[model samples]
Target: MKSLFLAILLLTLYGCDNSQNQSKPPVKSENKEQLISPYFGFLNQQKDSLIALPMDQAMESPEKYNYVIIENQVSPLGFIQNKSDNKESNGRQTAQNFANSEGSLFTIKNEIKSGDFGMLVNQAFLSQYKIEPFTKVERETTPEVKEKLEKKYKRKISKSTTVAVLKDQAEFNLTVFENQQDSALAVFSYIKEDQLINLDFPATYDDISTWRVDDGGQFDNEAFQVLTVLRSEAGISFVSIFWGAEGYELNFYQPKKDKFTSAAQAYGYSSPL
Candidate 1:
């Protein structure tokens, strides 16, 4: 189906509650590595406290109107507002997936976007969108076939001592560059697979780019090669779990790090990947 493309994902980490701590991700407990069970809970009293304040005042029955209006206040716009504040890059909404059928590559709608906590957003501002036929090829530049690619690209595109072209396969790279003017543009292929799928990109992605799918992510260090187990003092979720797959992080969420660690420890494969 057109909806079955395998979009890549990054990592997640724990965060602290706003009451005792605000705006900071949760810290990992020193003893947490020894405890990988998912029996945990936390609350962001800031959210609850907000709910209570209005309710308490409403219950007292104000002289004007005895009613509380608690709005979702999630700031759906906050997601894009953040990037606007950064003001260097624009966000693009992307829809991508992998299909077990043919012509699936044409379905990749890679958009450049950014994010903050709750959810990733796709902005319609000045963004670089991508589109092309999977069968189209300008050149090929693999070490094994550099000569062939050079010849192929020379005739179709620019002139280079060596050239490379994108096709409908899983071995490509996407690069987005923005200058001081905040004008952004991206160039990429119809396919590419990363060689080092690790476990720390999703969270990093939330802090930065939404278009940062699995293979397109950058790592802070080799530690990302393994699982990143952390706990959050922030809210309902207390644990964070990160797993490595295909040289990229598959996903990141809270309250599961301990469970994942325990499983790895039990299997005696807790070492870095």
Candidate 2:
């Protein structure tokens, strides 16, 4: 299965004869967005010019091309050489597995220059983990509930602050926390759904610094309700807030700013709970 996975991919993308001669500049009259539609066709058309270089090599001369076609799983580690026989054998297998899942292809335009491009790729490679989606069960935290929560939290809960819950349907107790700073934090804990037995995943904490709640417009500026909380099978979470007349803006809690497995995949969630 692994061999076939990559073999089919390579034959599809890399084995074809260079089709550069058949290529021509896009028609000037064509729509700009549609003109860029046949990016893969361009890849095959410029196959001869498209050097079969590693990512590092491509990064070095990123400006030479307008677009770069990369396999889904290309990593810098694949280019590294290991001297130890055992380590080399393991590395080779790991690299092969990485290459096997080449079901997708994408083109990265030269938006960032050499060093920045390399850094971007490195950051991406680090964040490629399987995410488990959480079930969104939105319940309004009323003023009375807020007062009760203050006793449990031991900190005076503000009337204006909003709160939401995400359950893993197992042994996880995930909650949101907002302080005087107006910054939100995702506090993690493990507890059974029915029994409420705390488990060993242990209580931990992380911040969703990327999401800035905009407090403006004619609506009650203090009322920042989490209108939506989206979870995916990949364990990713997204929160959408009704920021008054500013309407709604979607935000994700990224543990690492630079590392994202699939921004496109995350954006694919059309409906939220």
Candidate 3:
């Protein structure tokens, strides 16, 4: 009887100890590096290298990458002529001159020869790393949100508004308001938990040239629109495109030290009307 009691007590103690160990939190791997998305890495590489490769390289070696930028949908930066020069010639002439310029990375011959200038990505890289894609949330602007924005900007909001949520960690709100001149001005704000932050555009109103005129001959309002949102385990990137009299501007914003700040910029010339 004494031996049986001792055995039962030992069994109970072992069970309790095993249960406690299982309930403990997982042990994170030491010095585990965060994963960056392949697409984001590719963009960063291009920006850093500043070396444009011929479009035929991807085609000559199709097995080298899973995806290749066959055509440049957006105008490559640094190829467009000065905005001042644009006024001297017709739009078609300016476009033709731009195409023929030696400095231009994209040319009519390149387009005809090999689609367009672009980069290629390897399938193995994508399979090794996983990144979340941005999902578009409803455009419904809540009264609380609207009130917060109105109070912050001290302006009446227009119906042109959009909201996007990223990785369930960040919320973005783009709102437009009419300035004193009755032109559309975009205001971008970010929300995380109880924090509300606004993005200060790097370019001032004075720096931007509004050359496009409306039917009424008034300067066209710039439409600052979000182009893409990329998420990686390391960080989140917000890419936006807007136009001015000069051409299209691409701005890259990323969160750093608790605020979304402009990290990089690219420019593309608009095809003249």
Candidate 4:
């Protein structure tokens, strides 16, 4: 159910289509400007690294924070848009607040891969494909583990390219908007392009699940991979997986930290964390 667009082919040609695999166009080599988009998710996923955004503060009303961005604006929903009252934009409310108090209009164009993230990752990927904060990291792991993790992340992000890959380069635009007293909205047109991707692709959730997590006491099935760990001390800790499958994986270290939770990752990210 990919969104059909009039001339949307700016950069989405790289979407996985095994049947079209043979004739797939050459991977686009993007410049630093283009590579900046994928990091939009990093902002939301990494908000906890900020002391000001307490779990409680993060859950505050929509008008609170001030940054909103569209990182990889590939989808129709990703564009900043207002839903008409007449027909449903897949239930989009024409308005909705975002994590940082900036309201969101989720077109593949606006928020996630903002100029901030694109610039950062483009430079970082010069050395590696992904980047996370030193603060967000709990402790170090074996070089074997680190090496494996890097490979896994690179393989997964392969579906979305930039200066990082040969696929269509994705980019985002960040904007600041005040919260509106309105219902939740769909920022981008949602697609269930499930069948097109190979199940064995490392970026897929299944591959992430099997990536050998031994985060000391920080193990949670919900939070997987450095490329996608979402932490909110206030709500719940989670990581978005396999494109956009959902749910938070509550994490904590108990006495001796002997066991862990294995609940399936949440869908919709719909309910409260």
Candidate achieving the largest TM-score: 3
Candidate 4 versus truth, CA RMSD in Å, comes to 25.0
Tens-digit per-residue lDDT, 69-132, candidate 4: 2222222222233222233223211112133232222322233432211111223222222221
lDDT of 3 by residue, 1-273 (tens): 999999999999999999999999999989643322222111211221111222211223222333322222222222222122334444321223432322213111122222212333344433432344455555756677778878876777764344667667577777655454534455577676666767643221332442232213222233565556555454555566555555555555666754577655544444556
lDDT of 1 at 77: 20
lDDT of 1 by residue, 69-166 (tens): 11111121210010111233121111111111111011102221221111111222102111222221234334433333334323222221111222
Clashing pairs in 3: none
What value does the lDDT take at residue 129 in candidate 2?
Answer: 33
- Runs off by more than 4 Å, candidate 1: 1-141, 155-169, 174-187, 191-273
Worst 10-residue lDDT window, candidate 2? 34-43
Model 2: lDDT to the true structure = 0.28
Give TM per candidate.
0.15, 0.23, 0.45, 0.20
What is each predicted model's overall lDDT from 0 to 1? 0.21, 0.28, 0.45, 0.23
Which one is best on lDDT?
3
lDDT ranking of the models: 3, 2, 4, 1
> TM-score of model 4 relative to the true fold?
0.20
Q: Tell how far residue 206 is off in model 1, in angstroms.
A: 34
Estimate, for each residue in 88-112, the C-alpha lDDT of model 2 and write its tens digit: 2322111222222221222333232
Query: Which run of 10 residues does model 3 get worst, by summed lDDT?
Result: 40-49
